[model samples]
Target chain A: MNTVVRNEKYWLMAAGYIGAIFLWYASVKWLPISSFNRLPDPLSVIREWLSPDPSYGISIFTSDYYVHIWYSTYRAFTAFFLAVLLGVPLGIFMGWNAKFREFSGALVGLLRPIPPLAWVPLAILLFPGVEPAVIFVTFLVAFFATTMNTLVGVRSIDEDYFRAARCLGASRTDILRDVIVPGALPHIFTGLQIAMGAAWFSLVAGEMIAAQYGLGYVIWEAYNLIQYPTIVIGMATLGIVGFLSSAAIRWVGQRLMQWREESLGLGG
Target chain B: MEQVMKRDRGSNNSEGLAPRPEFGKLSIRNAGKTYDPQGSAVVAVHDCSIEIEAGDFVAIVGPSGCGKSTLMNVLAGFDNVTSGEVYLDDSLLASPRQAPSPGADRVVVFQNGALFPWKTVLENVTYGLLKTNAMSRASAEEKAKDFLSRCGGLDKVMRSYPAQLSSGMQRRVEIVRALVNEPRILLLDEPFRAMDTISKTTMHQHLLKMYSTCRRTIVFITHDLEEAIYLSDKVIVMTTRPGTVKLELTVPLPRPRTPEMTASVEYMDLKKEAIESVHEEAKKAFERGERELA
Candidate 1:
């Protein structure tokens, strides 16, 4: 009975969401005087999604919709993976030890205030290729935020914890691995979540400017062609990809630091 | 009862010695500490010296900022002294040069339990053993379980984090963590200050029982005269500011001290003397502050 009630509640929420979207569609259609044309009706967009190129003798599964999605998702994954590879270590180094903090902290601080898109010129000048540009922008977006938050987290750990570790005979390496890293993980995860969003935003911007094959490129291409349905489809795809990737980052964080959630009242 | 056992052991060991008497003594010879010469150069402790024998329970009592904590930190090799030296068992005491050895021989129980919030009670107790090669994981777990049982068996709350436990319970975990390694000298810094009266009494009894069984040298720092009197064999009275040892009073009270001893004439006299010493130091400290301001 409880599970049934929960399922009913879930359906209710879904209905409410769809109802809100329909309301938005009605307002946009009925309203007048705008440079951007009214968004295609929600049902028409859904129909386009379902039977995309039905007359082409191609399966719906192998349509442009899937291609667009695969391209967008692949780009996002690659950019995010590269961001993590660069960001996490830079963060850990800046956070875990004083010497690294002294050396790199000011430099990171100086670079962090500049928006990731501000580096577009530099990216173009240095590496004009589409992948390199996107990756560069993504790296710029993710690095500083992760480094700063990780530093805060490391600094916030109780001094007595270090003393206790030392008194118990922990080697410097052991302290870093067993204590410092775990202690700062929650903050590092938070930084990564923020970086994920930043990376996605920069990826889209980078793709819109220079990319040949990505969701942002498709959106711009559709806009020029005045294919409103395809444009909406591309926009929705970008939104969904960004949302899912962020949620996935949060999910990984929650799983790895499950104890922190229960104890620190975080990530619930 | 265990003091009697220790006395018997000491006597027997003393007789069997071939030539020289064994002196398990800790002597602090004219120790001094000054912080920040470019600043005010505050002397937390100066020219303070005391000697405690093995198996002795010595308490240092003084007013706030009298360097009681500083002295404790110095003894534990956590801080450097400006001058003078500390000798433990006739060897010069220095900061640890390598990973702490098994049975660290000097474990400190901080005022706050300072149990790692991320670790469970069992994990906290077994932390020191991680560096040791003597015990297998299973044996270490078994030993830790035994110590926890002595503390009060692990129930549902055993696996809970430090934040889940009460203040007194957290302190008990720290105490057990310190004792589990069987340290040679157990230094406690106001470990009972956070407890309620009932919990404090219970902890005092538990500590006494543990000391009696282990026969380890205990250096307890507190401001409470009654606590110092009740727990210590010798109470070292300290002056304020640039702290100096005023006097070392040996409590001749019989073993297994009871609460009634606090109301006894002898206990009252000793308590009065300790209070007077603190008051004098406090007054002098205030006057010195005034002169500095002027």
Candidate 2:
């Protein structure tokens, strides 16, 4: 009975999705073209997408597009990896040791609220060129949230776990590694997911400022030239990239926290 | 029945009848623990003192919020006492001891079992052996398997995680874990509270059997009088709130106590006494609270 209900729900979802796509195509066909006249028709776009002209669509993929994608991906990943390295330790330190929390906690609290985009001017002033700007913005976006979430995760661990570890003759370092790290993993992943999205958003805005290559730069350049298709493509690429990256992070999180799934009653 | 017979055969085959000191005597003198200094102090255990003899099965009974757990915490070296001290075998337990130095030889089984959720059943049992350099991994595995077998052997569930087991099964794992360690003092904090009556009775039997064989100084804490009466060699009844020892009643019942003994006249009388003492403690605790609020 439940399976039948679920089957019907899936069918309804498929129908709705198909209907929405058709409606979008029909609306685009009937709508009068204006400033956004370069808006490619759905069929034409699909045809162009399939049998693409190198000078038009495929050129975006070849020239500097790869480099731009690489640059953006690199910045996002570097910032994320660095955030994990720095944020997790700081979070653990703040969570485990009271004195460290008392000292560094207020500083984190003060800096956490300021948006990463707000750092663009500071990044420009501090360093030269696109790389520094992107890095700075990504770091700013990723660090605080990861650190705060990690702190919360560490703080919320069961006291019994700690006691059990201690009684088993676990060293302070062992407790941190074996008990605290695994205990805080779920929350840390949550922070990473949030930080990744923030970093992606910040990267786009950061790229708009002084980037020579990137999806953000492509969109900005296309907008200036009134080539709305390129702009739309850039927007679509960003959205797809963001969705895929978030999904990838969630996948990794699910694997890492598989043991916690039953306890949490998640993904039933 | 076959397993019990096998255990009997094994015991007969091994060292005859000399009792091994599973855990040594634990003495807590004037142990008092207070949380928060300036901020509305909550005194858990107030100048509480008790001596648990070697190989003695002891139960601490009290009303809810009676600081029974606090006393257990202090004894386990998990919490610091504001004043006073705890001594095991004449050595002071001021802080968590460094490895290789078996000061008190203690292991605690928590209310929730506190089994590492990440670890398998076998891994959890093998944890205590990991701390000591006394045994190799293979040897430890052998010893752990032996204990696991004795304590209703972990079947396919040996590889299973703690989250997979029933609450009773989890507690059994915890018991096996503690027993495998062969600690001098085994501290249990309402370990069987979550189990149903039948399971609880079965656990009590298993505990008595384990205790008789292991001969560890066991400190069982609970709010249940019947449980205390059934399992303990001596029962320590405690008052509530700023808790103190109310009375100590020794069970004259024979060792390897059975469930049938719970229905015995002496067992019933002891249960009555314990309940009455706890009721008085509960009344006084409430009156004290009312006075404080007033």
Candidate 3:
């Protein structure tokens, strides 16, 4: 009975997408607007996206499409990994130590307000290669996102937890290990999910300006060459891959924080 | 009587462990606590003195805002008193200028549950032993399992997270977690607050059973008059804000306390006296609250 209800919900959600595609097809074919005529229809875009021997250089069957995917995936993953490695500890230290919090809080306050893309010129100037420049820009946004969320995660813990831990004979290191870390895990995972999305967001912007490969560069290249359908294809690819990456992070979080799921009645 | 017999059956397995020595004698002398002393100082407790003998159960009751919890905090080493001193078995526990750091020797079961939500019941119970380096992991687990089973048959939920259990079960786990440490003094800050009457009554029985087996010194803070009279050896009533002991009633009732005793004539006399003393303070506190709001 539960599975039947879930299946119905899934089909209802799927219908939304189908309805969107149908609307796009109708807009281009039946609408009186000249702008709608200029836009590529959904069927033609799907055909071009699937074509083995396409008019444009990129398609699902071509090596170039996979190359673009690999490049974007590699950059986003690297940037996200670097952010988690540095940002988590930085956040923990800032929460645990007042002096460190004071020092880093000022630095973060100064830098976080500036947009990640705004660092493009400086990143390019600082690094000798375009790869480092784009990676550096993408890493900045992910780092701030992970660090700030992690810091908030640590702060959001109730003081009673600390009192209970102390009364249980936990030493300084014990409290940090058993109480602070586990207590803050839900927030840390929340930070990680946002960091993954931000990694993709800034990665694309950096690629549009600095990179020789990646979906962002492909979209820019397609636009310049007047391959309008390829633009839609590039966008769809970015959306699908970005969404999958975030879902992967969420899946990992659920496995690690099973207690949270159990509390919410979603786990055994 | 039935519940007491059932508890006796449950605790029969405790014969292997020797009875602990009665050693937690708490002494509080003219204790006073003030918050934000420099700016807008507010006195929470004043000239509050209490003497809790080893193996005795004492409950402190007062009106709301009467600083009962402040005294508990000072006793637990979570907060320092602004004046006077507190000692445990001749050792200075807290003074005007100094306060002992919270430790396993004085474990607290907070009003709201404080079990580590991430850890299982076994892990939570074994935490103090493992963290204090008092016992190895193997022995700690064995001891924890023993305590869990002895206290209301919590052994079945040993692997479950706190969120998976009922509120009553969570409170039971918290109590067992504190008891597993074998603290010199066990402090409870309204540990069973917000529980329904049925759960609270069951908890009272379980607590009595645990107390009989462990024989630890307990200082329970509560506003419930019946609870104070029902579970404790002595009940201390405090005046309103800047609280001080207004009355002390000793219970001459026998142990292995049954639920039926709550209706006895002797119990009613003690309850009436407690209500009369605490009622005046509650009225004062209500007026003070209104004045503050105004």
Candidate 4:
């Protein structure tokens, strides 16, 4: 019954978003505010997004919208998957093994601090093509986030869990599987969420610099053409795509860590 | 049913299939531990020696900071003694430089019952059996459920996680986990220290019941004199930091000890001896702390 009161806040959330869009509409179209007056109206942005305007840009009705969205999605997911494949195991090893930690820690520490954008020039020079270069930049961004987070996760598991496992007569393999993996899982999922966000952030930057087809490319093109409504459309599409991807990662994390969730008494 | 596990039989050693053998007779000879965290040495235990007969219940009582838990760690093979040796029957278990890894043969139940929070109560209980590969998965589950029921009031909580149960229930689950393995020696480091009065009494009763039925060798450490007197067959008192046994008292109180026996004169005399033995050492420790501060 108390959840009813707690849940009513969702209406206010909807109202707040709708109010902001309304304010954006009113300031530009009705109030004639100086800078915003010349800006694109919300209605025109929606109208342009739904129907064709070859002179202006492609809208939701055309295949161009999907092409850009799909392109961005593909690049982001591919980069993120590759980063996870390499980073999670590397991070776990770095945390668990002293010799491995000392050896790889130096390389990771030096490379992790360099901005993802700084890698762009080198990636472009090293890779065979621009697409590969962009993907590499995106992968680098996600990889650093994931590796550091996973390492922290592995390091943070309570020492008692390991001791408890040892007391149970668990072999080294058993301890790694039962104690270390499950103990580190909650942190790994947290890393995955952060990695997803970093992946999208880098994907846009990489695409803006060098990409044949993507939402970032579309946004840059619209800016060059002074297609203001189309620019807003590209941004809105990016926001939705990024949000959906992050939400998907969180969903998977929650499912995998349902044991934790259940123990914490957070109902599914 | 004797409420005890039988030794595994019909196994060939050449094929790497040795049936489990019964462990016995723990002996510690001049065991000591010292820590030097930042160059200065801090003695925790000094020349501690005790022999634990097979299946005997021994309780060690001392003031705080007396290295009781440290000694338990060395006994459980979680850490190596800085001096002397520990043995199980004829085999040397640990020495100054060598410590065996903690195994199913000796398990320690820590203060506050450190059962895995992520696991359900039954899962936690069955964990030891599964880890040692002592029983089939199906058999482990059945044994865990049976133990849970025999302990009483835990049948309904089998599916509940540690956080879902009270601390007392968690303690019970931890005990069940250790007992299911049929360990040779169970080292309980102040297991009842965190419980409330009602829960503590309940736990003591539960422990007494389990101890009588199973008759496994147990070493319990505590600060409570009355608790020590009530639960133990023999009580060993230790001096303050750099702890070594000061006195060993055998309780004449007979078995299936009840709440009523706690009021008996014998109980009071033993409690008095425990208090007297600890008082001098505790005062010395207090004065040393004061002098250091000054």
Clashing pairs in 4: none
Please state every model's RMSD to the true fold in angstroms: 5.2, 5.2, 4.0, 6.3
Candidate 4: stretches off by over 4 Å: A30-33, A52-55, B1-23, B36-39
Task: Please list the C-alpha lDDT of all candidates, in the order they appear.
Answer: 0.74, 0.77, 0.89, 0.83
CAPRI quality level assigned to candidate 2 from its DockQ score? acceptable
Stretches off by above 4 angstroms in model 1 are: A1-23, A32-37, A52-63, A264-268, B1-24, B37-40, B95-103, B154-158, B258-261, B283-294
Interface RMSD, prediction 2: 2.6
B-chain TM-score for every candidate: 0.84, 0.85, 0.92, 0.89
Residues A174-242, candidate 4, lDDT per residue (tens digit)? 877777777788888888888889888888888888997999899888888789888889889988998
Which candidate tops lDDT? 3
Best-performing candidate as measured by TM-score: 3
What order do you get sorting by TM-score, best first?
3, 4, 2, 1
Tell me the number of clashing residue pairs for each predicted model. 1, 1, 0, 0
> For each prediction, how big is the interface RMSD?
2.7, 2.6, 0.7, 1.5
lDDT of 3 by residue, B57-141 (tens): 8899999889988888887888999899999988999998787789888999999989999999898999999988669899999
Q: Model 2 chain B — which ten-residue stretch has the worst lDDT? A: B95-104
TM-score of chain A of 4: 0.94
Error (Å) of candidate 4 at residue B90 is 3.5
Query: Model 1 Cα RMSD, Å?
Result: 5.2
Which residue pairs in candidate 2 have backbone atoms (N, alpha carbon, C) closer than 3 angstroms, thus clashing? Answer: B23-B184
What would the C-alpha RMSD of candidate 4 be, to one decimal place? 6.3
Candidate 1 docking classification: acceptable
